[model samples]
Target: MKDNRYSLTGYHKETNEELWLWDDLPELDMEIGYKVGALLHYEQSPFQEISMIETKAFGRMLVLDGTPQVTAKDGFIYNEMITHVAMATHPKPTKVAMIGGGDCGPAREALKYKDVQQIDVVEIDPRVIEVCRTWMTQETDYDRDGRIHTVIKDGYKWIQEQKNQYDVLLVDRSDPYGPAISLYKRPFYQYVYDSLTDDGIAVFQSGSPYYNSDILKKTIGSVKKLFPIVHTYLCSIPSFPGGIWSFTIASKKWDPLKADLNGLQWQEAKYITPEVFRASFILPGYIRSKLEEK
Candidate 1:
């Protein structure tokens, strides 16, 4: 392994347990460390380094390029919030397009809706899906459901080819870096705007409000220029850096705040309820002030 700060190294010496340390927010001089009970799998894929490790705290975790992507314990919070908010907001989301959710967490939640007929998952790296399927057995079995069509291609290019097709578009990508950098920019967002139906709604996982305010602002700002209705929401995920994560929902016709989520039913969803949906959009003063910045 490379001798970088992000590398998964040996024992911590103090506790004598293997440690997987990630310097995700190096600019802030903050790092998150996990006690690794076992290293399940580690390899270099065509796009990035992938690792599956069992941690004492978070159970099985999927790490990508040294950053923790998802953990078995609290991943439901993220998956449920990202999927259900937009799903319930739109009246009938029949066709869906998901970009960068190779772990199938968002896919799993989206599939729970009976109105959803098909989902096109465009993932840049095939290895991410392969590795997650092998180790993250708790995730959705994509093979069992014919509604999911997996396309191993760059999300930026794949989205450009689509137009007025999907009823809902889910951008479940990582932070703006590496292969995902383009996904956060304006050109890619324009493609996302174009790919949606007239009444379509799109949801993106904007990063932490406390740490990634600039990113959240930029993402919402860009999408606001394209869509008539844009609103930002919040969810708490224990695995994330700031504990509080933001998601932006942009719609062509419907207002998410006025969404009649009373009829929507998903027994499998753990974090999101109709009441939770209403409260998620109620952003704090600090976050409102950040978005208001010039």
Candidate 2:
């Protein structure tokens, strides 16, 4: 028989336990790892270091700047939550703008809605798209869609050029580290505010409150300054550092919590349901208290 036991090549393997340690939380001083099968693609993009690895458990995974951006097994949790909640709230979100979703996950998820007529994906690094297309084909395929437009440019600068344009803007940006740092700032949220229609809605993946509480608080504060309705919700994904992840919705008009889901049908969704959608907004007291602080 060919040696088909899960391969652990190129990963930091221990003598007794073979694992790939994701050392993202240094201050917390803990690491998470997955047994790996193969090293598919690794590259240094102008923006960040991109790597695609085939894991023993989570299927194909995309890691940017040493953080797991998406995995085949549970990507729908992140993408669907980010896209559907806001998309469902708006009565007619024809024009959608997705900033920094280079892997095509968010674009693919957003494309599922029949109401979304046009989707513009502004990805800063073309390398992330190329790698994802070549290696992570199973999770994403928005490049083939005629309605989707892929722009290789800085998302912050790109959003500034538009005014009252997009009905739904989904910021599927990387962690607030390198080129993505600007996307989490107050000015960018103002740009996002300007880029939306009067009834437009926006949602971005706020980092984990378990590990990145500061990010969640800062994001809520910045967005609250511009939008009358600013809400934060939680979604859990195993591949990310903390099992619990956060996304914030900012809207000029519609309140996502009271979204009328009278006719929305999410046929392809593995995670999000109408009931789950409403429950996601109901945060725990601790997290709510954090957001409530000045």
Candidate 3:
């Protein structure tokens, strides 16, 4: 994608959207031709358009039909906070599993912790793995960590097959649709519960606070049914459909806000700061009422 980084060249036809393609595009390793125009991205079944688009800028970006979907850049803030906070608080986090992060962003972010020795990245699409390498960049340290071992398989299958438990389970998935539809199921949450060490924490990307409130609440409720502790947090990432997004953190033993970072200091990031980190946990009045939480 990067090698063939094509800007919106020219939109064609007068259908629902303005269809366009990259001129200097990479080999369409997985497409007959993409139907992308204006804001809509779809392809015929034999040439099915995308339900997703993974980019470093927007994080795990998705554009389905004619609407813009979630972006990973803003989503990463909550993800990193949820994941690293839990791991840092642990006495030691030697092993971790990230399900459905085909973009490999979370795996790249998790490697920042020196204590993390093994990170298993399970993505459902191998094609995604291929595209991301060209799209995400070879220069970023997030993608260049040594601890990551990529597994091209269904995350559920991979999680089920493993007997060895993990210190943390990060469900870095797209919104609960397409291949990700299975990820939101309660049975999957129970499997996640079984797959974790006694001290394990499971964190997932819930949808936006401003949009899809019902979906976020239902998903949170499901995780709450599966774990003793469940909490939702928020962040603002501009590229997503909604301006601010949410995440749910579920745990059996550790709570994120209370977790110590174990002196694993990181440099400043554009989104997640100490102040923003603390502030993100403080849900607004509207969102709190949405959860029916005081």
Candidate 4:
């Protein structure tokens, strides 16, 4: 294949190439990939293959199946953005629910807020949590946080039992494939709508628009039917395959782009400022045009 910007996979074996190429997926001919320094831990769980690696540039990384999920160097960008955007928009968010954030990045970030009292993180795989706790404990301290409640179960089934309970609901799923496929559909979003309070806010990681526009488009469309205000935001994480990744925010009452973002601060956040939050909603011409199309 032509090693273009959209090249899906790249890794060097124990040869002189000096790097290992990891694909976001092996089936997709044009999905993006990354180079890692060395594999730290690899295991085949009952759910999926879990791997941890010491990246050459992005620091330590947590991989699910064959794709990159979280990285130590810049994981703050994704986790911080996902939590703060919704947390700041709501006037007083006390209860939060997270689905598929097995790495605990979202839970740890959410606990940093003063108003947040309890955070319920529902992850399907116990292995992802165990591996991250063992290898990436410094980056995420979800287990020690008294405000977090970790539950291992199917996210789709878990949300159906909750109704109008959470002030903010975050879906930090891996990808729109496998078990996460249902999370991208409208019914699950309807459940998400019912799972949040009247003025609740929710955000989920839509895949990279540059490489996976279809998922982003589908997510926006599905979320629009349930929420009055829906906005898509972007962040650039070096560990992820595409240079740009996206998050779609669905608000029942407030507009995230217009949320009062004055004087908001995060303890260890590296990215995500009021200026960056505003700019993230302003999508590029090609991506915006594609999203606007019928």
Best by lDDT: 1
> Which is the better candidate, 3 or 4, if ranked by TM-score?
4
Give the Cα error of residue 268 in candidate 3, in Å.
4.5
The full ranking of all candidates by TM-score, starting with the best, is 1, 2, 4, 3
Please identify which of the two predictions, 1 or 4, would achieve the higher lDDT against the true structure.
Answer: 1
Score every model by TM-score: 0.93, 0.91, 0.75, 0.89
Residues 129-213, model 2: lDDT tens digits: 8898888754435556788888988999999999999999999877787778899887899899999998999998888887878
Off by over 4 Å in 1: 1-17, 139-141
Report the C-alpha lDDT of model 1 over 113-144, residue by residue, as the tens digit: 88889999889889988898998845445678
Query: What is the C-alpha lDDT profile of model 3 across 1-294, one tens digit per residue?
Result: 323333333223324443433222122242223344234232322211334443444444444332333354564554455465555556677798998766566676677677889999887666555545554424366455677888877887777776539888888766665667888887888888888888788788788787678778887888888788777878776655546888787888777677554443346444565555567789989888878952
The C-alpha stretches of model 3 lying farther than 4 A from their native spots are 1-82, 139-144, 262-264
lDDT of every model, 2 decimals = 0.85, 0.81, 0.64, 0.81
The C-alpha stretches of model 4 lying farther than 4 A from their native spots are 1-21, 24-36
Residue 101 error for model 3, in Å? 1.5
CA-only RMSD, every prediction: 2.5, 4.5, 8.0, 3.9
